[model samples]
Target chain A: MATKTLIEAIREAMDEELENDPRVFITGEDVGPRGGVFRATMGLIEKHGPERVVDSPLAELSIIAIGIGAAMADLRPICEIQFADFIHPAMNQIMNEAAKMYYRSNGTWTVPMTIRAPYGGGISGGLYHSQSLEALFAHCPGLKIVIPSTPYDAKGLLKSAIRDPNPVLFFEAKKGYRAIKGEVPDGDYTVPIGPVNVRRAGDDVTIYAYGMMAHYAVEAANMVAEQDGIAAEVVDVRTILPVDREGILESFKKTGKALIIYEDNLTMGYGAEVAAILSDEGFEYMDGPIRRLAGPDVPSVPYSHPVQEAFMPSPKKIADAIREIAEY
Target chain B: MADQSVDLQANAASEQARPSDSLSPEILLEMYWYMLLSRRLDERAWILHRQGRIPFHISGMGHEACQVAAAFAINRGVDYVHPYYRDLAMCLAVGMSAEEFMLGLFGKAEDPSSGGRQMPSHFSHRKLNILSMSSPVATQVPQAAGLAFGIKYRIAQQLQDPEDETQPRLALTSLGEGSTSQGEWHEGMNWAGVHKLPFICLVENNIYAISVPMHQQMAVPNVADRAAGYGVEGIVVDGNDILASYDAMVRARDRAYSGEGPTLVEAKTYRPVPHSSDDDDRSYRSRDEVEEWKRKDPIARFQQYLLDRGILDQNKIDEYEARAKQMVNQSQSYADEAPYPEIAPSLDPSSVYAPVDK
Candidate 1:
């Protein structure tokens, strides 16, 4: 095992896949000599050359479209979007073409491609640079959404996403790129697409989160455990679409309380979906109402530090919400 | 009206000097047959839609010559096709049977494309290498580029040999004139040109995008002009002239195979009918204009050519028409009696993620 950052893990995943399979290639903006905007693909071009590590033009539609075609042509293409917020231009291709290729063709065709985007807000990236679009893409059937919180999950889930037969939207938390480091396995390993990882086992309340928010949830759980003696179980939902429903319910059943924390807007966020699932199955086991601590319904993410802080769900806010749920 | 006839005669004269002169009389006759079959099938589909038997119908009446010619130019089952909605002739020419078209029209379980999941005109046949189409226009353009990139990459890496007859594959994608205005179209064409990928972007300029006319869609006189900006060759042909289209497509395919990158071929034609069952061209276009275009109907012009060449007489034309009609009728009846697909439950939860080995 080696200690690595989330971005390092991602690069390693792509490097390993490119080495393992002849069909595997990386394509996106600045993914070649520049090594991506976030330096996630640094030194890949030097190792794999331009054909394998393609530096594409600034067009998200073609980026995903080429990935679809390459995937259909029996090439495993890993397409990177500079930021998740910039992915809207390619939404039609992703939703209509990539997501529906398998079912629409009656299994005659499959788009085995992975679209990686750095998502969420913590870097004061303003509106256009920071956005969490997991809920929107997760609503699209035939697509698997994998959000990794740590370097370990980032590496493992990305490998699995590259190998999956269907299209996968692998959202890497930009906030946790270098901020969150963990010991990842040295060699080949894959965390399955859909499974909830119980980070800290507790019995008082279940704290559900993914991506960068998972770390905050653990921090909040720690705070609650020290201050209020409320043992909170931190459940890192690795996959958002085909959610770890059984594991979530099991945690909720054990804790008798649930609090969903996310960076997306509160209205119809992934938290709402988790809350609905718990409401349907774990309603009888609930001690109080299922709560959600998420971003407000603002038009765009704020640019200012103070305003952005207010916009985001910080650990203090999550801890306070967890304490309130623990008391309830 | 006099000027239009002069242009048609000039187009016919130019065809004599084109590469189509090398085509055998038998091949020319076969081209005419597919074009005629597409027109008849389109007419039947419109009638069925009017009778409320089908939900929708997109006619390929005026576009048959170009679609068939392009299909004939490419290697079937080898080159990937990203066909648009009005590609009945293209699909038929690529070996999609009348039964499959009828099954798709009726949304029957036996439909080869989507098993009734997709609407009619969203053509897909796995054996023919036709990519499934979506309602969103111009989305397939980029996909075609990507497919071409895959083919080029495989050949260059020696993963697949170019010397192999079927090794060097090209991608052919069709779209309406109005679709050229879409950003995806430009992006896709640009990517193909940048990568020097083997791709052909065929724009069937039928003069109308539903109610909107082509003049209102773009300022450019021809859709192929946009190809210049992408650093690719652009060519225009009389879409109503079968031999002209055939020559253009043959040249385009050859250029692509020789690693000359993509070619944007604009086939200038007119939609003889309303865009689809839901559209009414009479509201936007004049009846007089439609009549004038009908006078230059591709099928009639091809029939005239066949008679002039002594390849087909009136008797042969009648026989071919009769066969096409019989095939359409039999397929319609078969599809009408076909059952809807039975919805089945998923036996494995991870089927979508992991391919279950058969």
Candidate 2:
């Protein structure tokens, strides 16, 4: 096992996939020589050469549409959107083409491609550079959604996504690129896309989360264990599309309470979907109604430290929701 | 009418026929029949749209010859095709069954193209190497170029292997005269032409893009002429003439296969109906222009040429029309009997919809 940063793990995944599959390739703006905006594709152009690691023109639509065509032609293309916020311009390609191509043709055509976007806030990158748009894609079918909280999950889930026979939207939190570090296997390995992992075991209440929010959930779980006498079991849904329903249900059965958290707008966020699923599948297993702790629904992330702190779901918010669920 | 026009043009070619050319009379007849089936299917779709049986339809009426001829000249399954929404004729000419085309229009579970997911007229068949058609115009151009590049890459792999029979040439994509206005069209063409990729850009210039006429779309006068900027040769053909479409497509295919580079064939034609079922062409186009085009109908000219040459008897014409009508009727019945997609099954696979673990 090698201790690697999120960026290094991402680069390793690309390198390994490029070496393993001839059909696998990487393409995006500044992805070839510039090594991507986040430098996640650093050394790939030198290692794999330019043909496999292509730097496309500034046409986002073309970049995505070409990737789809390439995937349809049996090439596994890993595309990057310079920033998560820029994905709105290519929504038609993702929603209409990538997400619908498989079921639209009744499995006749499957787009085995991965779209990597650097998401989440905390770098003071402001509006366009740091938004989490996974929920927008999570709403669409015929697409697999993978979000990694650790370097191990990042590398393994990415490999799984690259080989998966469906379009996978791989969301990498920009905040965790260098900040997060974990031991990743040096040899080839893959983490299945549809299962949730219990980051910390407990029986008081369930703190369900993913991406940057997963870290906050774990932090809150530790704080609650130390101070509040409540043991919060945090479940990280690594993959959002084929969400680990078994993991969620098992956690709920143990704790009999749930507090879903995310970094997007509070209304209609990823947590809402989880809440609905638990309600439909495990209503009797719950001690209290599922409560979601999500970011405020404001457009601005605010420049001031206090307002910025108030924008996203904090550890306090997760703990408060956990307390509400546990007490109920 | 496009079929009739091509037959007339082919008859005009009999005196110049060379014995060395492998394109025989039987092959020409087959090409003509494909065009006829496409035309009949297109006409039925228009009528169905008019009668409210289907929501909308786009007719490939005047562009039948170019589409059908190009389809026959290319390799099926081995080659890739990124067709525009209006290339139903090309899809049928390539190898799509009439039943499949009808099922797509009906948007039924039995529709092999989309299984009722896509809108009517969006054809997709993996077996035929036809990419799923998107409603966004000109989006397929770059995709076609990339797909052709991939085919060439695969062909290089095959050539390295001892037992592979893949030739590596992929029949690329085609779009409308107005679609050339899109940046993707130019980007795709430029890439294909610069690399001398095995790609072909067939421009179905039907003179109008909904309310906007050809003059409004581009100031360059012809879409084929834009090929010079892309570093490729261009050919202009009468899209209404089946024989001329065949000649242009055959040459384009040969040029691509021989590694001479991509060819831009601008087939000049006109739309015989509104853009879609909801469109009112009369609001924008004059009746005089429509009548003039009606006189130059391809089917009428081709049928007359066939009758004059004694290749198709009067009884054969009746039989062909009857067969076409029966096929369309059968397709409609099949779609009607087919079931709708289950709502529960449409949930996200990674989340709510996965089957419970055993």
Candidate 3:
């Protein structure tokens, strides 16, 4: 097992996939010689020529639209939206075109393309730069949303997402790009797209999360255990699209007290869906009220330090929520 | 007389569909047949809508000549076509059967496009290389550019010349003049021009976007003029004239294949009927205006052209019309008998994403 930062592992996955498949190519603003705004695709152009590693213009709509077209042309394209906040311009291309291509064409056409957007609030990017839009895209049924919290899941899930037969939205945690480091094997191993991993097993409550929040949930579990001796289970929900329903239910049924954590606005956030699913089918197994710790319903994540901190869900905040839910 | 004959030869060479020589008289008639068939199918669709057999209908009344001509000029099967809703003629020419069109119009179980998922006139068929259209206008333009870029990139990867006779094919996308105002459309054109991708964007300027007239849509009088913004060649032609449309499409196709990059073609036409069955032209437009454009109809103009050239007479024209009517009738019967789609599959969340659930 080799230790790699989240960004390095993502670059390794793209490099390996690009080398293995001639059909795989990447297009985005500043993705070529500039590598990427985040340096996720650094040196890919030199390794695979300019034709494969294209530097697209600063137009998000066409960036995703062209990827859909290229995929229809039998070439697998991975289009980067630069940042999650910038992906709003491409919602039509993602939800309308790529997501529905196969169903609209009655299984005749399929868009085997992956859209990468760096999401979550961190780095003091203010309102425009730092945002979590996975909840927005998660509502789109035909799309598979993947958020990786660790370097291992980032590389493995990214590779799997690139090879998916349909459109997959892969959102990386901007806060965890370099901050999140984990051991990753140096080969062709891939974590399947639709399973959640239990980072820490417990008996009191199930803490569900993804992306940067998943790491926070793990930390909170450790904190609650060390301080209050609360054995909390941390479930890293890697793929939220066709949610690992069975795994989530099994984990929830095991620990009836559920605590869902996400960085998006709490009302109707992705965490809400988890609450609904629990209430819908897993109602009888409930022991405590389903609690959610997420961003407040603020219009934007402010640039001011205090406001930004208050807007973001931290490990301590998650630990407090876990403690409350466990006590209940 | 000799000078006049030479001028006629030049006109024929410049305007007619290509075969290294002028199109054979039979081939000209065949093109006319597709136009007539498209018109008949469109007429039947409107009647079905009126009769309550279908939910809605969008007519390609004045667009048949340009649509079919463009398809005929390109290698239909090999080249991808991202067509707008009003492209029945193009779909027919590019290899979709009349029954298939009717099935889609009726939204039947066997409808190849979506299996009744989408509304009528939203054409899509994979084997024919017809890109599936979404409701949002001009969204297909960027995808069309991307498809062309993919083809050219593959050619570049193989180290082959895109200018060669048949190595890399281009993508042909059509939209209404109203869609030209969309940002995605501009983004697509700019991308195509920047990459010098083999792409052709066709604007069927039918004067209205539903009810909003072209004057309100954009400042430019001609949609082709916008091509200058993207550094691409632009051409305006009378869409009612099949020969002119085919000639322009052929020239654009040649320019793209020769690596001259993309082209913007504005075919000035009219939508004689309302935008769709749901629209009402009487509210905004005058009957005289509708009648005026109807005289410049693509099908009637092409029919007259064929008759003047001795390619068709009253008898042949009648025969073609009869065949088209019979084909439409038969298609209607088949669709009428076809069953509606099963609601379960569409509702099932499993098939929503490919490769089934993980």
Question: What is the DockQ (computed on Cα atoms) for candidate 1?
Answer: 0.67
Tens-digit lDDT track of model 2 for A36-152 = 988999999999888788887676776777788778878889989888788776787788778777776767887788999988876676766668887888788767889999899
Chain A TM-scores for all candidates read: 0.99, 0.96, 0.99
TM-score of each: 0.96, 0.88, 0.96
- In angstroms, give how far residue B209 of model 3 lies from its true place: 1.3
Ordered from best to worst lDDT, the candidate numbers read 1, 3, 2
Segments in model 1 whose C-alpha atoms lie over 4 Å from true places = B1-17, B344-358
lDDT of 2 by residue, B1-358 (tens): 1221223343333346522155666766676677778888888888887788887777778777778767876776556777887887788877888888877787766777777778877878888788886787887787777776666655553422312335336656888888889877877787677557778889988888887888888876678778998887787777777666677777777777777888888877888788887789999889988898888776677677777877777898888788877887787677666776665654545322222222
Q: In candidate 2 chain A, where is summed lDDT lowest over 10 consecutive residues?
A: A299-308
The CAPRI class of candidate 1 is medium
Candidate 3 residues A1-328, lDDT tens each? 8899999999999999998988899999999999999999999999999999999999999999999999988888999989989998898999988888888887888889999999989679999888888888888888999999999999999999999988999999988899999999897878899988998899889999999998899898999999999999999999989788887888889889999998888898988889988888899999999999999998668899999999998999999988888888
Interface RMSD for all numbered candidates: 1.8, 3.8, 1.2
The per-candidate TM-score of the B chain, in the order shown, comes to 0.93, 0.88, 0.92
Cα error, candidate 2, residue B146 (Å): 3.0
**On residues A1-328, what C-alpha lDDT tens digit does candidate 1 reach at each position?**
7899999999999999989988999999999999999998999999988888999989999999999999998899999999999999999999999998888887788999999999999798999888999988988878999999989989999998999889999998998899989998887898888888999999999999999999999998898889889899999998997877898899999988999998988898898889999999988998998999999999668999999989999889999998888888
